[model samples]
Target: MSSIKEVSLRRATVADAEAIAAVRVEAWQTTYRDMIPDTYLDQMRVEDSFLHWKQILQALPAAGDRVCVYVAESEGHIIGFASGMLLPEAKFGMQAELTAIYLRPAWQRSGIGRRMVQKVARTLQAQGAESLLVWVISGNAIARNFYEELGGVLLHEQAFSWDGMDLKEVGYGWRDLSVLMASVNAMPTSSSVH
Candidate 1:
């Protein structure tokens, strides 16, 4: 078992697309099991998403742009990632969006998620963002609780369809980027490595 202490995070590059895609696909399957349609998860392929990830990484943020992606790695393999972006207009009064954040099931609750989120928060804060928001499946209690623990407030819920499955996504917002960043920084990543 790898300890959270073994993880290292850094900005992701185009070369990391495949590994990042793999993590996303795997995490979605593991984390969203009954919470989502099995067909949606079953059809997810790292290879199929490889180009999508490549395009995201290939598109470098222009001047004044806030889009960013960070990857968490251990043993030279990418284990997780967190990505965020700033749209041209604010939605739900939040300029920054936590576009995506996923980790292997085994990696959750080990402090790596906090570390990845901190990187995203710092990126958004540096880009003059006052706050950020993330959308999580309404049925994902674990993810919702994690965001709540980090000072996110339940802002709203929007109904959407995924692979023909009706679902509600809850919006979690942090009104202050600094508060989120500070709270994440204050967390102990458990230095005792096993």
Candidate 2:
């Protein structure tokens, strides 16, 4: 981490759709290479992601599944992003499902991912989400460790099929979103570089 002075987190705009899509595609390749099929990754279309992000950006704030996307910008470029939504049937009163979280491959271990996830927790709590939950491919040891180090608990493991392969995913959860927030908020702000 370079100790950047300013890393801004702001609500994503429609203009950010293309950038967001690029981040997703790149992150997916770096983070899910072995977990997902190359065929699936190969077929991923930026057009699809553009359309998806466009819809998300255009939705009214009150729309139930309308995700609140946040981008972490440094030096006029987006290094990471996070997306989350309220889960209606959550075991906890108001739980948020973290749909996606990704940082550029070059930015890993720079604490940007940690900051983004913490921001997501605070954003979700403000929206009445009492808990936070994330799904990770079971084989992804790196991601599992990251969440665990961030105070997430290994809740359960479930099996599903993806790309015609049997895949098992692990669920990591924060029963109290505040806990997650505290961990993120307590971080040294001096980590960000300008």
lDDT of each: 0.85, 0.78
- lDDT of candidate 1 over 47-68, digit per residue (tens): 9889999998888545235799
Question: Quick one: best TM-score, which candidate?
Answer: 1
Candidate 2 residue runs with Cα over 4 Å from true position:
1-6, 60-66, 91-94, 162-166, 186-190
Model 1 error, position 172 (Å): 0.5
Q: Estimate each model's TM-score.
A: 0.92, 0.86
Q: Please report how far candidate 2 places residue 156 from its true position, in Å.
A: 1.5
Candidate 2 minimal-lDDT segment of 10 residues: 185-194
Which TM-score value belongs to model 1? 0.92
- Residue pairs of candidate 2 with colliding backbone atoms: 3-192, 4-192, 4-193, 4-194, 94-130
Q: Point to the candidate with the largest lDDT.
A: 1
